[model samples]
Target chain A: MTKKQLKNLALQSYTKDLLDQKKVESVARLLTRFQLKQYIRELRNSESQKTINIVLPHLPAKTDQQMLSRLFAGKRIIYHVDKTLLLGIKIIDNDQVYDLNLKDTLDNLFTFVSSGYD
Target chain B: MIDSQKIIEQLENRLMSFGVDKKTQNMGVVEKITDGVVIASGLSKCFMGEIVAFGNGNYGTVLNLDEDTVSIILLGKEGKLKEGDGIKRTGKLLSIDVADTILGRVIDPLGSPLDARPKIKGARAMPLERIAAGVVEREPVNTPLKTGLKAIDAIIPIGRGQRELIIGDRGLGKTAIAIDTIINQRVSNDVICVYVAIGQKQSTIAQIIDRLKEEQALPYTVVVVASSSDPASLQYLAPYAGCAIAEYFMEKGKDALVIYDDLTKHAWAYRQLSLVLRRPAGREAYPGDIFYLHSRLLERAVKLNKKHKGGSITALPIIETQANDISAYIPTNVISITDGQIYLEPDLFYSGIRPAVNVGRSVSRVGGAAQTSAIKSVSGKLRLELAQYRELAVFAQFGSELDATTMALLERGKRTTEILKQLQYQPLKESLQILSIWSVTNGFLDDIPVESTQRFEKEYHEFVSSRNPKLLETLETGEKPSEPTVTQMEKITREFKKIFSF
Candidate 1:
């Protein structure tokens, strides 16, 4: 197919996802692996009540959990521990991720310094 | 060779300057990787043109922002980027640090030194893509940006803010003209030069740098190289990066000249990036924005008005045409964008015209405004005379009978062409250029054999300088020679011819 036709196909798939939210999960299952990921991400951004995943190098305190629950009020939270983060937390909400980590900070600092601070 | 110790020290100082804050980064997961473009999801907060870091320690610029994913064009290697790999937005656009320290350095598009020298400690960062200066910020181009070649300086005069294209077929001395212009800038300290070598062979770039060094032009020059071996992203970014470096100087009330030693490769690199991103292709499979790509870049070379400090960025962009076809896509786009063009011809090159500039096709839109009074006085009618001679000479090639006027015109044109023949890398001073043109136009070389004109010019310059130093000074002042100075010059020329037998 020509590029334009392929682009139209992709557009149609996303349009279908937007038009019928309940059919998204079923249509996503029938899609290829890449297409399914894209479809699910698009569907998640279409509305609220997202399934948010929180990963941290260590367990959060009770106070931190209370704050997190309040921040994502309408969403369902899934928790996991990932040691690679070194410290701090990664919150994944479908197409949006918020990373507050020492690893990312240090990496950014190194890139900033190496690239010359102007 | 980065001075890691110095960089570490500076980093410590920078760290001390930073105040602690809650750091948050928008993250993405790599969905697919193909041909230096990464399709990633979870970066819904990522804005267009933001710099993103891949899990593999690579960095890329976000190009396409979609409903589901962001398409990033990698600035570095894509070797280890995999599906499910994480990416983070830095919330910054692509920029390069530029400073006076960058002068005399060979740098990549990222402003990193490639010559194994110390890392540049720049005071300012210039973003790669910038809006062109508005019309209110500009002034008319009045001063000449001399290339020091008689053919160009006399006829196709380039102004301080002009965008003059050097165009021809491959290997037809386009780079030679640009290099000569750079070397000629060594005569003046006011204008700094930036040479951007895009997609050229490394060996060729090395040779050019070595030539700049040999000419002592490297001291005030910056060489930005994105060789053929580099990824298309860097090659595409090279010219804009070079322009950014030049703008640093131009905005500081200093004159700057920038040469993109052929943008055809730059266009090719951009085409590759666009195709990889799957953008719709236009004619020749190039993206529709191809014309906009060059227009924006060329428009930035402008002369700011007196209120804006009167600094200028003169661009001499070279474009390689196939079979001398200026009608081709890239060549025509550049030609229409530039103020004028110096069109070199293969036939003229083979015929031993070093610059090989086809005067018929070549023109300076700046006209006589860019020329010094000394040169303008002598070259006022030179272009018309040469054009007429060319037309008559073509008819004369049929072996038909010709009038005396036609014969004289042809002979004068031959001597004029011969006098304009300059040696490679040996750019003449304005004084010498005027003297040479003055000698020919004043009919001093009419009786001299055409073959001996070069020798006569050399001897005449030496004699005049030794006998009447004030004449050269007058020419160098850029003023029209007084009637007495002209009379003295004529008298000296007649005496010199009499004293020496040819």
Candidate 2:
């Protein structure tokens, strides 16, 4: 999602929490506790290092964490197994994406090769 | 006939021979897009003036390198460039291809073919911005660059490598003078001409091209047009591009002439680009670097020394003034940068003086040294006589009675001014110009009426050409007139005077 879309989603959830807060006193207390936890998580997210969201063909073992950290130092790593990735990895940083998947790489290579003749 | 199978086979072989290498590229995201300017972030490695590419494959030139973002001026159409589109550095500064084939062609600032003809081939790329030749590499201006106008050739002669500013209000024949100069180059065998039209109307450019075509000067001239419809970036780049093309020939040890037809619009375009890029504006809302911009461009006109093949570039930069305000910021900046100025006056233009050159204001500092001796011998006395006549004519106008000498001076001045009035696009040869000026300064035209001076000049030139062609040849070969030549000219002038009736 874009930064703008993410901000809009946060505003919608806040409105939902606000409506739930006025329902019942017991439920309102429980909602306040949950809101506090959500606020803390947001603060942590803002203060933590930028996250690098990665998509791979399959989930790797936990033993690969050290190697992944070595490759992307000082960056928080999150993984998602995408079946369509086929054989390689796709890493998305803040404003740039590293397309290392077989399909995307082949597509880029075809374009790079064909554009020369034209 | 061409074979499609063989072409396909060659293409396949080429594609197989090419290997893809994985290299990390510095990337950025467009933060904003406004008025052909793109503000992007994460392009920290991009240098100033570097060429960059957008996601849509269009290109831009980096103008502003900020802390986190860079400002790029788009060189092409602004369509399909989104706020979050990807940007990548091309690692190249702005440059254009220049070659001999560019002559007789009309091109945009980026060297694109605007004439709708076939694309030029064998062009070598030259950077738009370059350092000018240093003082040690240059020699003093010692050869004349004639404009074919009698008044200018007499008083305000331009040297081969001098920068002469043509300043005047609009409709005062500024461009006419430049076009005449270019047309005059037809007689000069070695001079290459480049005309850069910046921010002018499309119709006006078309008319100029049509005129050039009519004159048959297109074979030796290159026209660079960045009209009012072009983006400000292209307008700002036009003069520099023209200079680079001229410099290409200059590097090959050839004489070249480049004309910036009115830099006022070029300044306005630069101001627009600077404001859009958010640079700090100075006096007149122009950026502080405005002076430097023109200085660097004009400084490129130089006369190289012997070791550099004796090539030179003469610059004639036209600046249009509002209400004849030469003290305005742009005019003064350019006047100080150029060697001298040819100030054209609207009043003179209205008075039927076609060239309309204001003698007192127009001066050429470096031209005297390069003037031909035959012209120099006659022009010096003519200027003094004209200046004196102008001063005394105002005094003589207050009273009907005057001395014979004062009457003679006024008559001479009137006739001299009439002689200097020349039509556009008909550049007189140096021999003919010298012959005309020599006759008047030597009192041969004193008996001729003021109204009859133009007729007398035409008859005298034709008589000399038809009767004694060797005299004109001698003058052309840079020989000053001896007693016999003067006697021969006088004999013919007396005969023409008898037959010439007012």
Candidate 3:
């Protein structure tokens, strides 16, 4: 089968923003072992794009969590906290990040100042 | 020194006005780590030759892209990266920082200071790999780029903006000839020199730097080094780095000379990187684009027309052959790419010829058009005569009686060869080089024994300078000799012949 056909098969394995177990099993049966691995990775990537991870300095109140859920609507919204972020929040969308915090700003400033010497 | 008040003012202003903007980047996670290459996934937006930064401050260039991953060659010492490490796109192409301050400084491929000196500032970025100037922007090479060696200057003359390959076996003074060319530029002081040392020993490179410093050639020279201990990515980038620096000067309407100490190791470095990245290899296990690897670099050697500031970059690329085999894969590729080659032979080198330049095989495609009219008139028949002498010498080796004319030809050839044997680091001026070749080619040195030819040529130059400085100055003008000049040369030869004892 053509690679485009395999890509379409992988994309179709999901239903309503999540992997359908029955559809995945039937698709896996149709593909060779190598194609199955690629199809699974594509499925994982599609699933990942449906979720947005937000890291903050402290846990948000229940109202704020509900607000984030409302903003994302049907997409998955997971929140975590780390003290090192110092202030503000970080949003990670798979391989890309939207960092807005004092720690990252300070880190970028330090890197810029130190690199001038090298 | 930095201004204290300005810094304080800037800090206050930044504190009042600074706001963080939304900065976005495509990122990747390292999936595998080979010797110096990193295989990364999720960099689907990354483009080839784009510089990517690791979290730990190390950098890499994306070399290959596939269906699921990108292969990147790390640009420096391994930064202790493991699988699952992260990298971000830098939004930059690989380039070297260049400015007037870079001249005389030893730098690495990334333009970092390597000579323990202060870092260069206010440098504009010149891309390491640039498209060469097209045909419409180019002018034909018409000016001489003298090496100050008798054989090369008179016979195989190199022109400004020419790509001349210096091919030879190991330890045959190929680097010495290149150094001599760099040092000889001191006379003209019109060319900026860039010497790129690839896969060479650090100690050797240090010695070359020291020699250039002692000769005062360092002031106009820039030494770019990617030593053997450096990573293959750096070694592969050395020549292009040097070329970028030279191109900086060329674009500014100044002549520049770039010497790639040896490109054989450069080919090896690329081959290593290709194999590690799992690219298919051709003959000698080198990648199929091996020829393109050098052609793109050498094609950057161009002479811009007057409309483009009339600048030029002369390239002297050295290639080492194993056991004098020029037909080998890498050597033949470069030999065909360059304008012409100076073939250095081990046989000539071992037999006491210093530069070891094989005149028969060595040729300059630019021809005598690059030479000055003075050297042109005198050395016109020198190459043809030497060819004839070599052919007759083989017959004379049988000790058979020959015509007097053949004997005369052989005598003149011997003296010519002796006079061409120059010592290292001693590059003669154009006038003196012309005088030596003129004496032999005009039959003035026929009666002088071969053994005394060296002594004779040395004293003759000194005598002309001391007694008749004006005549030497006339020859230095690079114009054809007037009748009075020829008459004076003959009279001086007659007088010197009487005073000299062989």
Best model per lDDT: 3
lDDT of 1 by residue, B1-502 (tens): 9899998887798777554342655678898888888988778788888999887888899999976578999997788779989887778898998978999999999887899987787359899999999999999999999998989999999999999999999998889999999999888778999999999999999999999999999999999999999989999999999999989999999999999987999999999999989999999999999999999999999999999999999999999999888999999899999999999999999998878999999989998999988889988767767887798889888999988998999888888888999889989989889888888877789999998998998888889889988888888999998899889888989988997668
lDDT of 3 by residue, B1-502 (tens): 9899998876665555444353565789988899999999878788889999987789999999998789999999786788889998987899998989998899999999988998888899999999999999999999999888988999899999999999999999999999999999999999999999999999999999999999999999999999999999999999999999999999999999999988999999999999999999899899999999999999999999999999999999999999999999999999999999999999889888777999999989998888999999977778878899889989999999999999999998888888889999889999899888888888899999999999999999999999999998899889988899989988998889899999
lDDT of 3 by residue, A1-118 (tens): 7767777887888787677999999888888888887787677767667888999999999998998889778888888889999998888777777788888888776665555554
Task: Flag clash pairs in model 2.
Answer: none
Per-residue lDDT of candidate 2, residues B384-455 (tens digit): 999998898788869878989988888888888888999889999999999899888878888888878888
Best-fitting candidate, scored by DockQ: 3
> Residue-pair clashes per candidate, as listed?
1, 0, 0
- Measured with C-alpha atoms, the lDDT of residue B321 in candidate 2 is 99
Pairs that collide, model 1: B1-B116
Question: Candidate 3: which docking quality band?
Answer: acceptable
* TM-score of each candidate structure, all chains considered together: 0.90, 0.86, 0.92
Q: Distance (Å) between predicted and true CA of B396, model 3?
A: 1.3
**lDDT scores in order:** 0.86, 0.85, 0.90
DockQ of 2: 0.16
- Write down the RMSD of all candidates, one decimal each: 4.3, 6.4, 3.0
Q: By TM-score, highest first, what's the ranking?
A: 3, 1, 2
